[model samples]
Target: MMESYLELKKRHQKEVNEFPFGFAFSPAQFVEMMRKWGLDYEKDINKIVSIGNGGYVQKKDRDNMHEMFSRHRKEIRDFISADESGEEFVYKMFLREMRNYGYGWTGDPKDTLEALGLTWEDVQNNEKLLNGFNKASEVALRKVI
Candidate 1:
């Protein structure tokens, strides 16, 4: 089941990379996505929380959060590598990471672009489009989690 979930996650990550922007996912959408990934929310939530809370820092269970972020990064990297979308995959991967790891206003487009080796100017140039994409992903994430 874990392998199946991982495989499904890999496939979705690939799809996310290939497309990068434009898809609007909701909480229901995410639940469906998870289902497709072979993940059972009831069974996996605690594990996800545990993984998400792991970190090197010590502050209100910061380590656990850091650990989750670390796991998420690894998963993102694996998915990005398997993506067939070429260079665009990197951008898409960053966006996905931002949505998953970034919280509140910190999930800005500039931050996401910088994380992807892009400059603010690059994001500024494509502001309208990226904002839409980011909003869509964020909304979907909020609904699912």
Candidate 2:
């Protein structure tokens, strides 16, 4: 199961790295990926809730995360409003958020991406970007675990 998750993670990372501008995954795709990884989505969701309760995100980091999420949302909205295809805008937004907040999905990013018509690959690339995303994700995972 861990290996499957790792494989999915790697695939997601590759997609992000390759596109860095497209971030769309249908709900089915997202859920299927999770299922394929042997994760019970509900359990993971509960784990996230537990992590929040545990407070490992820290007040400061939580505030920072909110700020980051807000900024990314605004950026995406502005980008979308500027004459691009909704899909393109969405893909950019997904990449932006994943690039900034990390891409653990938890479902939010994937939903947002689907709404905007982007894919995971659209927003992931560059050694620095991937490293940063993974680092953030690792932190989140550590908190949850």
Candidate 3:
């Protein structure tokens, strides 16, 4: 009585392909949009896509941040290495301000800090930390912000 996943997927694809208005989306995207917002596939496509405008932009921004970070990862890390807490500051800033800028935080504070390859006392009295961080931020977020 119930369709298999493949059958349902095929049907959804067919529906998405046949829909004639607004924008076009793949079946998987359509299904994800529907599932994320709790809507029916037949009736809610346009509504969800319309409401998804902000989500789409957010996704694009997040993706761009990731790409930029990846491209400049070594430079960012090198700059943040100026201070023991440099990486931590960036991590927390991303969490609070950027929300999903994708700065590669490990979720564990100790591990994240340790990844910086600095000891606790290594940063004591270090004065170039802020300058390094500023340069790093400029490099890392040049395209993002």
Candidate 4:
């Protein structure tokens, strides 16, 4: 079943609200957290996640992840600003994609992923084209909280 916006927010809040400071974490732990919360992860094959690699999310890896996240965030924001109706356009396209992907009858975020033909791998590969939808989902998800 698809997770509700409230449910996602609740989970996100639960995890981040009390995140420990100065507590070191391995990439595996972070991946586990994401999985527990139904988040898509592109870090599956990382050596650190496997415990056989460096065993921690190394500084370089952490920096790379931050860079990737920033890039996607900027693209989404840019898309939303490029057109006066940019936000509206993403929502419209999200709805259309949902319908096209056979979720025409529902408004679910999981369905949104499916509608856009996105797996985490797909998102990783085609983020420029689809991150706006992802960003829109994040905005909507956060707003509900």
Stretches of candidate 3 off by over 4 Å are 1-25, 50-130, 133-145
- Provide the lowest-lDDT 10-residue window in model 2: 47-56
Please state every model's RMSD to the true fold in angstroms. 15.3, 19.3, 17.9, 16.2
Model 3, range 1-145, lDDT digits (tens) per residue?
A: 4333234335645744543323226777756655654567787544532424333322223454445445444544443453355445343332232223333332222332344444434434453544333444454455455
Cα deviation of 138 in candidate 4 (Å)?
Answer: 22
> Candidate 2 regions off by >4 Å?
1-55, 84-145
TM-scores, all candidates, are 0.27, 0.26, 0.21, 0.31
Q: Which candidate, 1 or 3, would have the higher lDDT against the true structure?
A: 1
The CA root-mean-square deviation of candidate 3, after full C-alpha superposition on the true structure, stands at 17.9
Clashing pairs in 4: none
Cα TM-score of candidate 1 = 0.27
Q: Least lDDT summed over 10 consecutive residues: which range in candidate 3?
A: 91-100
Q: What lDDT would each prediction earn against the true structure?
A: 0.47, 0.42, 0.42, 0.47
Q: Model 4 misses residue 18 by how many Å?
A: 32
Query: Which runs in model 1 stand beyond 4 Å of their true positions?
Result: 1-60, 87-111, 115-145
* Model 2 root-mean-square deviation: 19.3
Largest TM-score belongs to which candidate? 4
Query: Model 1 RMSD to the real structure?
Result: 15.3
Residue 41's lDDT within candidate 1 is: 47
